[model samples]
Target: MPRRTRVLLVLFSIVTVLCAWAGLMGLGRLTNSGFLPDDAPVRDDNRRLSAHYRAGGADLVLLVRADTDVDSAAVAAQGRAVGERVARSPGVVTAVSYWSAHDPALRSRDHRAALITVDLVENEGRATRAAQDLVPGLTGRQGPVTVSATGPAWASVEGMQQSRRDLLAGELIAVPLSTLVLLFVFRSLLAALIPLLTALVSVTGTLACLYALTFVMEVSVYAANVACALGFGLAVDYGLFVVTRFREERAAGAGPDEAVTRSTRTAGRTVAVSAGIVALSLCCLFTVPLGFIRSVAVAGVLVALLSAAATVCLVPALLSAAGALLDRWDVFARLRRARATGSAGAEEGAGWRRIGRAVCRRPVLWALAATAVLLAMLLPFGHAAFAPSDARVLPAAGEAHRTQEQLRRDFAIVPDRTVTIGLPRGTDRAALDTYARAVAALPGAAEVRTADGVYRGSTHHPAPAGTAPVAAAAPAGPVLTATAASGRESAEARRFVREIRGLPAPGGSALVSGEPVRVVDTTAVLSRALPPACLLAAAVTMLVLGSFTRSVLIPLKAVAMAVLSLGACVGGMVLIFQDGHLRGLLGGFTVTGTLDGAVALFVLVVAYALSVDYELFLLSRIREEYLTTGDNTAAVIKGVQRTGRLVTAAALLVVSAMVALAASGVTLLKVIGVGLAIGVVVDATLVRGILVPALMAWAGRWNWWLPGRLRRRAATGDRHALSTDEGAEHAH
Candidate 1:
């Protein structure tokens, strides 16, 4: 081994060990935070409401299922007791129940259940701790009623727990399965192990980086799962490229050191470009202004960069150490020997070569057919709908989801969806009353309540004596709460909030705030940010690909291909999750008629980057072959033959990890997992195998064309110099 390589190996080893330790130490302390952006308007409104009304909404809720009538004295007494116990619990700010409010809406329509709403102090960590402490004591049986606890605070804690379990389960399934796939591909145990080790190190290092980030800013619970899956996929991808190239070099008669050097020069360059593409694509998430999206981006970028670093610095050193031993301990030694002897020039992908030749034989026909199929797949995305995350995102069997469903089914009012319009403080009773009446008159508005009374569709009803609070004591402002006729996720509810916001304020300054408004605002933010994000991703991808390939048309074609694959993936998500197709086969989630907006955006960005990832792998090899042999057709055929199997193997490994994520009980994670898996499969099979080869064949020598100055330089032999330097830099 070279002295420089040995030194790098030692440096990387120390860093890897430190990262592993930091990951372990930080894993347990990672908190589930950053669900909402700090600067969101809805957050400010929620804060104002909490301060003024002493109601932080329902942080915890106890569902009291009565054996007999819910309104009966026994059931009422039990409900009150449960409410009082929760109110007295540490960190609880207030509690309300059917007994305290005497509100009929708290009682189930079947007269078999009632609800107790508890508002905890507005500290996430403290509130979660208090809620956990109170759960055991408050849940189960309370006199004649069976008590079950759930609400935002409890759900937050449970969501974090569930996410951790899902990550563990996904890794358990993905790691073993990925190992088997790698072993099958390489037919050597040592070769198989190297990629997994790199993945572990990269993922652990990313976790450590995320943990450090948590101290400075909130990180989402979902980031861990995303980081693990992406880290594993990217690490294995880079490793596979490097190792496969090394073996090919070795098979072509290079010594171990020379093989390593050549493989690093070629495959290492592709890995660097691929990593940069992924990092730049994820950086688009920063434009969305939501913590959850930003956290995923942060974790993704960390994993991609770290994986590339390991691939370039660590994997080569390991390969140098392994030398000729990489081919030993093969589980499929006979097949490996057959492969080595049967194929000349290390072009072992005869099957892929045949496919590429077949496509090139009728390039126009193949390209048209593939493009038509992709467009047909994209048809469903035209009807795609989106909703913000909510309790429905959890499993149906979960307590939080059950409570949410029960509330929706039994109660006339949806508290979470109820929009609160805050008028100026000291607003007169008549002005508040007029505002309430106007809000009630809006379409889809069920009822509007103010300190004066309740109003329905322009009709005012005075509150019972002493029920209406005197306006003189109003501190934060006079509030009119409007309950939507439809559920929060419904278009009617969203429209209602929008219409209400468009209405003239009685006090000349009113803030409309609630779950529906939050959803609307979040959607709006994402919608506004998406165009710029896409532009940035495209610009960065074009720049990176142009730099790597030095061809304008190739980068443009690559970007278009990425968009096509992403469109198909989005269409598939809409068809399966939103349109409710294949629900029975893919874990029967309640087809909520809409995809989570955040999840959809996340899938688009990540999947596009990954699609581009494979493109770079194939195109870089093709470009290299063309530069060397000066024949575009032979270059395309040989490039596909050389890299096709490796690309498919990497895709299989990534898709396997993604498919494992489908086992998660959370609907959002399931959608993301399934959607991403589908994307990889499509990109690997149809896009990479068929479309790319056909398109390159049809483009011919034009695929390698450069502008005037670059063309002159290439003709003068600067191209080789540039490519060599890029390969060396990326290799180390």
Candidate 2:
């Protein structure tokens, strides 16, 4: 065996060991989703709300009816069975169902519908367990009972579970698909396996690291899955370019040792540079305030680093070990014959090739046109409104929605908004009475009361048994409370809050905290975070590319294109999901409102980074052609033609991967997936494939222009590019 072959074997052995360890660890983290922090911003809020639910014993469940007219006994029995099961669950404190308790009016007139409330345990993991175990078990004899379980617990659990499944599925599909593509590209199974093996090693290792992270970090379920997707996707993507180049060298008849060195120096450099760009892009996720988005950014960086490692260390070793098998694909044979023919008709150029040529020939107009279209699409985003889909968060639509809705319709005196105003001890008693009177004077206000005040303006049963302590607390200033007849009259509520806020100072300030207020706050936070996040992503991209390409203007151009693509994607989502259109086509999900906070942050991160994928791919290839022969026009045409297919494939694969997420049961995941898929398609076809080349063609020398010092350095072989090219020849 050659010295190079021996070294390759050693390296492969190391990667194999590392990968095995990583697989075990990754599996452990995935299985222990509950152990992960509730890092989702929604989950964080849910945790706080769940505390209230637990304390109040206000859990919710829905009774799905097979018959429109259900009998009393059947309804009672079904409710009893479900309630009993729920009570036995880890987090359930209590259960109220038709059988356990009687509410004649609460049941549907025909007995087709009923409501149940199961108090949830305060533990986070317990909530997930209850959701998974409880709701699926609620069934009837006629048909599987459709139980929509919604509560803090179910929301947290279902979201996490669905995310985990989607990501695993993506990995399951991505690895095999990428391997197949790589095999076909190389035509040598051994050559194909090299990149796959490297990617697997990276993925396994990343998973293990993620598993370990669960102990310390609040890794979002979505983020964890996304990390795996990115790790696998990028590892294979980078390794393919490197390994293919390595095989090319071997097929060129270079000795094993020389090929290994050359492949590393060339393809290795490109991998390093590409990975750097990818890592930098992923790092931009940090700009988002939401925890899930931040987690994605963190995971993105990790995967990029892992990919870089696999391409440099792992791919080289595999190439060396494969030896002559690297070119077993008959690439050398085909190339020899092709050279002999030397005819344009024998060229691999196809429709995409022509597209590449056309794009390169008219760079500026294409770029402008694409940008305008994407910007136009983004127009709908201005009207985007985010309303939480409570149904989407739950395993099933539980009793909360129906009960709340029903209660609103029947009981006008009951407060629709459950407000919990926290105030400091010792407020003025007369002021509290004055505020109470003020609330009563409001047009829609039906009731206003402190703890001791009566809703009907008279005491019921002389404070009714258990409320005697209320008299003791009715002194001048404990914490006056009031409930409005309807939540929709937010203006009334706000007026009340303003009155309270403006009241003469007590020891501490007061805050009106409730579901409605919190929703508004979360939405506000998201809105504020978006602009900064976008700017951060742009700034980071410019900085990273500036360092790698050493051209400030090139990086700026990339950012501009990326922003346009992102805007287009957002606009499209708003039109499709927010405008209440196309719900039937997309798995019957009604677009209730704007994209949620987590998804919005996620979209910004992914769209911005993904937009750059093809831009870098095209520019790198174009730069290579330019370096080989200082002819700008020929480089643009040949480079675009050569790299276009790979970029297009990558975009399609990415879109397919994201689209697969739409199949997930969770609504938020589906939205993120669909939005990303659409964005990638538009960016790949309209922006990168057509517009980028057109812009480059228009820019000509300017695209490659750099400071004199940087231009000299760009001429010098950076280690990243040198290693990248070195591997290409060997793998051929």
User: Each model's TM-score?
Assistant: 0.93, 0.76
Top model number, TM-score = 1
Model 1: per-residue Cα lDDT over 1-732, one tens digit each: 678878987887788789878876776666655555556677776666667755446667778898898768888787777777777878877677877766555678887987787767665555776787888787777779998877767777777778888888889988998999999998999999889888988998899998898788777778888898888888988898899989988876777887888788778978988999999999988988777889889999999999998888788889998887897899999887797788756746888999989988999999999999999999999988887777777778888788788887777775676776777777787777777787899888998876656788978876666443211123666666788988777889889988988888865777666777877887777778889999999999999998878788998998899999998999999999898888888777877788888889998999999999998888887877787788998899888887789889989999877876787877878888888888898899889998988999999988878889988866667466656755754664
User: Residues 1-732, candidate 2, lDDT per residue (tens digit)?
Assistant: 567657766766786688667655554343222211233233443344334322222334444443544444654566566667776776566565545544332355555655565556545445556666776556335232344444444456556655666666766666666666665566666776776776667766766666677677655566566665666556767776676566556667878777787768766776787777677766655655555566667767777788788789877777666766666755456775676587656555466668767676666667777777777788898987664344443223434334344444543322224333433446566654554455455554445444445333222212333332111232223433345544522445545444544554345444443334445545556666677766776777787777756576779888877878888888877887677566667665634455565566676677777678667767776777876677877887876676666666666556545655665556666677778877788887788777777777787788767778877787675545555554555464
Residue-level error in angstroms, candidate 1, position 645? 1.3
> lDDT of candidate 1 vs native?
0.82
Local error of candidate 2 at residue 517 (angstroms)? 2.5
> How does each model score on lDDT?
0.82, 0.60
Report lDDT (Cα) of residue 344, candidate 2: 53
Off by over 4 Å in 1: 1-17, 69-74, 88-94, 120-137, 335-347, 464-474, 714-719, 722-732
Cα error, residue 69 of model 1, in Å, equals 4.1
